[model samples]
Target: MYLIEYLKSADSLTIQLSLTLLFVVVYIIVTKLTDRIIRRFGRKNEIALPRVVYTIKYFRFVLLVFILLLLGITWDISFEGLSVYFLSFFTVAGVGLFASWSILSNVTSAIILFFYFPYRIGDRIRIVDGDNSIEGIVFDLNMFSIVIKNEHGQKVTYPNNVALQKAIIMLK
Candidate 1:
């Protein structure tokens, strides 16, 4: 009887705590699942462990932001306040980030290429961009760009974003 009375009296707080715990549990489970999938895919593709780890770190950041939003809602925090803060922050940061948005795109593309790109280092491939087509052996893959050495021994650095946008022909 006393426990029931206490629970009734603390209903709001109890519900809030329960929801927070649930969110944390769910977030943990999701993180583990994603990490497992990433590792499995990386192993299957022979991707470098460092690249897989970096991808997992990026995923964790996204998950953290989602968990924060979930907790905020559970606690009845004001969305308007968060929106205003983020608006101001992004507005100020956007200027600089926007100027170099291509860099960001390259990084994103690099992550995608890490897992799904069929061509690997030493693979001979051709990028079919009319008037700018490139045929080369992939020399290196970096976060920002792919370095390829052509038949003439000319080294070309192609941005990851552009690589993804262009059609690739696997010569070998």
Candidate 2:
């Protein structure tokens, strides 16, 4: 009864507030539903990789951000006033990411190796490095480097980026 009367008498500001609340509720429901579905799929497939898990989280974040942006536009939040700040922030972020290129490349290679690498742990293999070809058993796989125990019993840790670039031979 009170709610009906309020809605009937709602001014422009009140109506706008109600719409904003509705959008937020919808966004929350969508984000939660998507997360639950992805969680179920991950559990069913036994997806334990950080790459896949992070991708899902990033996707949800991006979706929520897009929804928020839409809501901002709907409520007349001024992008013109914020554009310069966004540009400055991105420029700084670009430089930082560029400075960490090597680390980033190795991490990217690790993701590729996780999905497409054929060799298993304990497999004997040779990475064709010309004068310093490495022949060893695969000891361990890490996010940045792969560890192999060479013939002389010394463990060699090669960056994953290099591993992806070199040709590998399985010696069985």
Best by lDDT: 1
Q: Write down the worst ten-residue block by lDDT for model 2.
A: 46-55
| lDDT value, candidate 1, whole model | 0.89
Tell me the spans in candidate 2 whose CA falls farther than 4 Å from its real position: 1-82
What are the clashing pairs of model 1? Answer: none
Mind giving the per-residue lDDT tens digits that candidate 1 earns over 24-123?
9999999999999999998988776767887898888899999998899889998887899989999988987898898889989998898779987789
Question: Over all chains combined, what TM-score does candidate 2 have?
Answer: 0.55
Q: CA shift at 79, candidate 1, in angstroms? A: 2.2
Residue-level error in angstroms, candidate 2, position 49: 7.0
Per-candidate TM-score against the hidden true structure: 0.81, 0.55
